[model samples]
Each structure stands twice: as C-alpha cells, then as structure tokens.
Target: MPTGNTVSDGVGAFQSREQIILKDKKQLDCENAQDDDNDGHYKATHPTSYMDTMLHLFRGNIGSGLLAMGDAFRNGGIIFAPIMTAVLGVICVHAQHILLNCSEEMYRETKRPKPPGFADTVSLVFAHGPVKLRFLAPTMRAVVNAFLCITQLGFCCIYIVFIANNVKMIADQYGITIDLSIHMIFVIIPVLISCMIRNLKFLTPLSMIANVMMAVGVGVVLYEAAQDLPSIQERTFLASWQQLPLYFGTAIYAFEGIGLVLPLKNEMRKPELFQKPLGVLNVGMAVVGCIFISMGFLGYLKWGEDVAGSMTLNLPRGQILSSVVQALIALAMLFTYPLQFYVPMSITWPGLRKRFGPKALVAKELGYRAIMVMLTFVLAQSIPELGLFISIVGAVSSTTLALMFPPIIQLVHEGHRNRLTKYIVIKDCLILLLGALVFTTGTYESLSAIIKFFRKES
Candidate 1:
C-alpha cells in the first residue's frame, strides 16, 4: 500500500525488517552481492532508508568549502558573487534534475534497476565502452577523476592548514609563539585519528558536529558584525559593486557541495525520495551562504580592505567573543576536511585499485593514504596562509566541479532536442565561463603575490 502504487502497477514484494538489516555483517558485504540485473545495476546490501538518503544528500553538499566565500568576495567583489552564485545554483539544480530524469529513463528502457553507487549507475546509462588507454571515452573519464581527486585532496589539506593557521593567529594575539611544527602536529593528530577509522557510519556524528559548528559560527559572526556596524563608517554601495567579481567566486564555492550526492540514487530505499535530501542540503547551504554574505558585506563595509581571511580580526581586539568565533571557524573547517577528501577519494579508489590491484591489498590503501597525507603537509608548509588557500581551492576546483561538470554532463546525457536541456546547456556554459574567469584571475593573482614575496625576500 505504498502511496505511489497504482491499480495498473503490480503489487510489489514486501520484506521483513530483519531482512533489511542483515544479521550477518560479512554475508552482507558489497563485493559478495549479486548484480541487481544484467543491465549493470547491483543491489545494495543495506539500502539507505529514504530519510537517511535525504540526510546524506544534504550532508554531501555542505562542507568546509564555504570558508572560501569571504575571500572569493574579497577578490571578485560583492556584485559578482551573489549574481554568479544564483546563476550557478540554478544550473546545478537543473543538471541534477536532468540526471535524475536520465536515471528514470534508463530504468524504464532497460527494465533494470540502477546500480548502488552513483558513478556506476550513471556509467551504465551513458558510458560508451571499455576505456582502453587509447580511447577517448577512457581518456575523458581519467581526466575527470584526476581533476576531481586533486581538487578534493587539495581542499582537504587546506582545511587542516586553515585550522592550524587560525590557531597560530589567535595565539599571536596573546603573544604566544607556537612553533609551526607543533601547530601542524595538533592539526594532523585529529585528522589522522579520523582518517584511520574505516567505517563511513562512524563519521556521521562528526558530520553533525561540523554542521552545528558552521551554524553556530555563522550565527556568532553575524551577530558580532551587526552590533559593531553602528560604530563603523558607512561606505558607498558602489564600491562594493566595483569589487564584485573577485568575491562572487567565493560565494559560489560555498554552495559547491550541493550536487555531490547525485550518484548515490540507487542506494536509497525509496529512490524517489532523493529530492528531499537535495532540498534539505540546499536549504542548509543557503542558510550558511546568507550568514557569510551578510557578515562579509558588513565586515568589508566596516574594515574596508584590511579585512583578512578570518573576519574575527576585524572585531575589537579585546573582545573575547570574537576570539572564540575565530577558533570555532577553524574547528568547523577541521571537521569539514574529512568529507572533502572522502568524495574525491571515493572516486579515486575504484580507478586506482583497477590500475594497481585488489582492494584487499594493504599496500595500495597505505600508499594512497600516505600520498594524500603528504600532499596535505606540503601545502600546509608552503602557503602557511589560510584565506589564500581557500581562494585557491574555490577558484580552481569548485569552479570545475560546480559550474563546468553539471552542464557538460547534461549536454552529453540529455542530448540537444529537449528545450530544458538546451536552456540548461546554454545557461550553465555561461556560468561555467564566469567560473573559469575567476579561476584564471585568482591563479594569476596568487602567482603574482608569491612572485612579489620571493623577490622581496631575495
């Protein structure tokens, strides 16, 4: 008696609650499972109930990436930030809708349920053939995974670096000179503990903690900004507009996590309920964005160009509350890092294991983990700057993932005939171009800054 079942639809088979839970954990393993059907869909051992599915969707879209928004606005300007963000949001939503439609179409056409994993399900629909080394399809897939892997890993590193640097910055206020190595150790120890844990389920509570931290941090910062605004000089709105382009990229980056849940549709108990999570996730992201935009606007309005990565510095130095705000933001980013690394790592794993060997092989797992950790350490060392790292992550990676891939996938998946498809393709391409411009501009600016610093040192 599920609501959607019509008279014309055959009565569906029902299962007991015990059947769903699977008493024997080893028997419920993913690798041992039979394929759902001949058309490439594989049944999941533990289907995520519709409610959990929705939560996962939202969680996938909310992460530490939002830390970049202020810096993006700093460079792109206020006008550009909001405009691009609205545009990008619409495009991503449309692409996600199209992807869902494609999934439904494939289900009907093939009469086979979709696979458990997101990427695998999508590949069944639009994947060309075996990606031989010389084949274009394989090459494109490789490039996409490579870009995704590098971006996520880099963002993950930035999270640790941001936390450590913020810690250092706060300590400086009290004249505490903590050595850089000790600061890094503090950041790494927590991350290492989290990373070494095997199960994704174990991290769910941590995810909730991170989300609450974001909400509270944004709340505290905005409250502080509003109270302080009265004493600060009123600035012209035109100046905010003039600097808009530099910051728009940052705001868009805040919402970059919105669509990452698309690939997991098949695992949902009620596949149709996927949209609920998508909605929840966006609502959460929008709330965060509002807090960031308001705080960034007020902070910039008050402090002008002196505003650095952490807006807490802009508040009166003696304000203990502002210091607490700074610490919370860093902690939130620390919580966000695991999720960021996790996404790309998920994608990278299948490809890497195929290239290397079986997943049971410890060497492969250890090697990949070591590489990821080492790269994070290197970025933390070289940059030693938090906001700058955020800008780099948002400008480079978020641009490609958020703006570029959605439209490209739509064009390829939904062919040109559909009006909605055509509209999305056009609209997303323009937004993608805007993102590309931000990427190029941000890269150039960072390079210029690095060059200037080196020249001065010499």
Candidate 2:
C-alpha cells in the first residue's frame, strides 16, 4: 500500500534486510558523538535525515490496505468507524512505543554489537527471563518471524487481488470482462519476475514511481468520495455484533506497520526524536490517522452499504480519470510487490540458506522466490474476495504481531526485571484478551463471509 522515499524505508510491511543493513554494516565499526547515551554504538551510524524518517513512518503505515477502511466503516457504522479508527491508531502507536521501550531495555541489558531485529528482541527477552521460560526463546523467535512471513506474504496476496480487481474494473468497462481469479493468474508471472530483482538499489525508482502514483490515486479517491455525501443521521451508529469482528480485522489491517518501526528508528540520525509527544511517531501517526478516518468516513457516507472492498472501485465508471486512477494505483502496487516479497524472502531465506549446505545458493534462492510468489498468487486466486481476505489476514497475522505479542513481551520482560506490577498485569491481560477475541471471531466471520461469497458466485 505504501512506497517510501527510500527503497528500505518505503516499499512494504518490513524493509529488506539488505536495505536496512546496507548502511548499518559500517555502524558496527564507526563511532558517533553519543558519548553519554546508551545506544551509542547503534546510534553512531546516523545517516537518515529527520524528514526522511518521518516520510518513512508515514508511508510505512499507509498502504493499499488503506483503501479498505471504507468497507471497514460499512461493517461498523458511519459514526462508529472513525471513532474506533482513532482509538485503534492510538493503541497501535502505544504498542509501538511499548515495543520500543522493551527493545531499549534489552539494548542496555544485552549490549550487543548492534540493535536487535524484532525476532532477536523476542528471543533475547524470553531467553533471559525466568529459567522455566528460557526454552521458549527459540520458539518465540520462530513464531515472530513466521508471522512476519505470513503478514508480508498476506499483504502481497492483497496487492495481487487489488491489482487484479483494478485491472478487471478497467477491462470490464471496455467490454472485456474476465474472472478475478484469471486476473490474479496474470499477476503471478510479473510478480514472480519482479522478485528476481535482489538489488535494493534497483527498487528505488520503482518505489518513487509507486509513491507518486498512489498519492495521486488516493487524492482522487478522497476527492470523489467526498462528493455528494449523505447526512450522518441516516446511518447506523453501530452495526450488529457479528460484524464487529470484521470491522476489527479491517481496522487492524489498516493501521498495522509494526515491523517497520524498529528498523526505521534504528536507521535514524536521532533515534530519540522518534519517541514521546511531538515526536515523529506521534506526529506521523496523527497524520495517518486523520487520512484513514477521512477516507472511511467520506467513502462510507458517499456509498453507504455498497462500498467496494476498495473505495476506488466505487468511483464513477466510464470516466477517464477513474480508469487512470485504477491503472496507476495498480501499477504502483505492482512496483511495491517485490519490496513486500523481499521481507519474507529475507526471513525465510536464512532457514533455506542453512538447508542449502552450499548447493548452488543463488539458484536455490531464485527458485524459492518463484515458489513463494506463485504461492501468494494462488492464495489470492482461491478466496479472491479482497475485503474478507484483508480482514482474515488482519485478524490472524496482523493481530498476532500487533496486539498479542507486544503486551506479552512486555509482561515477560517486566517479570524478568522484577518490575511487574498489578496495574501492568491487568492492562496486559486486557490487551491479550482483546487480541484473542478479534483473532477468533474475526477469522471466523471473515471466513464465513468468504464461503458465502463463493456460494453466491456458484
């Protein structure tokens, strides 16, 4: 959904390992002017500018999943959606800070060569905790990386369907109707080819193009969505209990960019600027929040129950601007797919690299990339219901990464530090409970909705 100023900062859910570490490899040896600071080693290599960091934060949090906020609103209500979005945005921001705080504690504790990746932080926290739980360290690390794969690949699946849906709409307008699955099949080859591009440098131009196109496309969508809106009094304040999970799933998916946080902060010149009030995280997320709320509010009031999975689809047909917007955004996502694929590939490749045992490593990596690309295409083709698929992924993978993991990590780490308190326990328990509720019910409802969609199609 989002592309950044830098390939590493902008392309997808998580930055490419190569992209993130390309500069940091020097940081391991170079010295910065943080003589009194704890993160002196890591912060020593501060090449990223503040404005660049803010842009990365904003772009990282906003993406193709953003367009679905309208359908999310349709599931909740006209009034309820915006309020919940603001609330969720605040929670997501808090979770990021919780994660940042945990990592800061670990940075001081471990005093390793460099900053820990998400997986490393989880492992180190659990491994150093109470002895009984130490054995779970590897498992927790695997779980975090596994969900990273699932979450990014899930976003790739979304991009495929999104691109196909946009293309199909254009074709349908020209009397060239085709099945959505068929459109996804067409996406597999190009996406597969794009994944072969291993150089992060090569992705920069693509990212730039994608960002510009998406900016224009979203502006047009907002413009069209704001037109001829109905009164708020006519819409429901809240939807039925069954639809609440769907809304939760969609909202989570829309707000999540958790994996990008640490890497972005670690890459910054002043990592301290990323935290607290008036910081980049707060300011950027506030902007992201307003945009999301506006998109949902206007798109819902403009289209009500009939809002498509992407509000872009609900734009007036037969208009050249509409077709151009669709095509442009579709192409933008096309450019972003490789960046998205790179994260999972980075995580999944390390295991595969160990498995290779020196049997033509490069060739094996390329082949593995192809299989994963096709895998996303196949998954998208199977369900092919963009809205429901977004919800399911949000409910399952995004919820795990965002809600379930952060609080538990904090609790475990706090216990290890003898800092655990009654209030912390209570608050963490509530977050975990909410995560569990959303994961179970949202997955069930979204899957049921997908089933019904297929039944109706048949």
Candidate No. with top lDDT: 2
Tell me the TM-score of model 2.
0.93
Misplaced by over 4 Å in model 2 are 2-39, 44-46
lDDT of 1 by residue, 1-458 (tens): 00000000000101110011111122333443464656445555667675564454444443444434445545544454455556556565555555566546645554443321223324433453233322353344445555555566666666666677667767877888897657887888777656654444565566556656656765675566566453333443333432443354455555554234444455555555556545433454455445446655666555556666656445566467767877876776665555455555565565567777665666667567667766787777776655555555656765665556555555555552244555666676786676677678756665555556557755
The residue-by-residue lDDT of candidate 2 on 207-261, one tens digit each, is: 7787788889999999998888788887777998888899999889877777677
Task: Report, for every candidate in turn, its global Cα lDDT versus the true structure.
Answer: 0.52, 0.79
Clashing pairs in 2: 1-63, 1-64, 4-10
- Residue 51 error, candidate 1, Å: 7.5
Model 2, position 122, has a per-residue lDDT of 79
Model 2, residue 112: what's the lDDT? 59
**Model 1: number of backbone collisions:** 15
| lDDT of model 1, residue 72 | 50
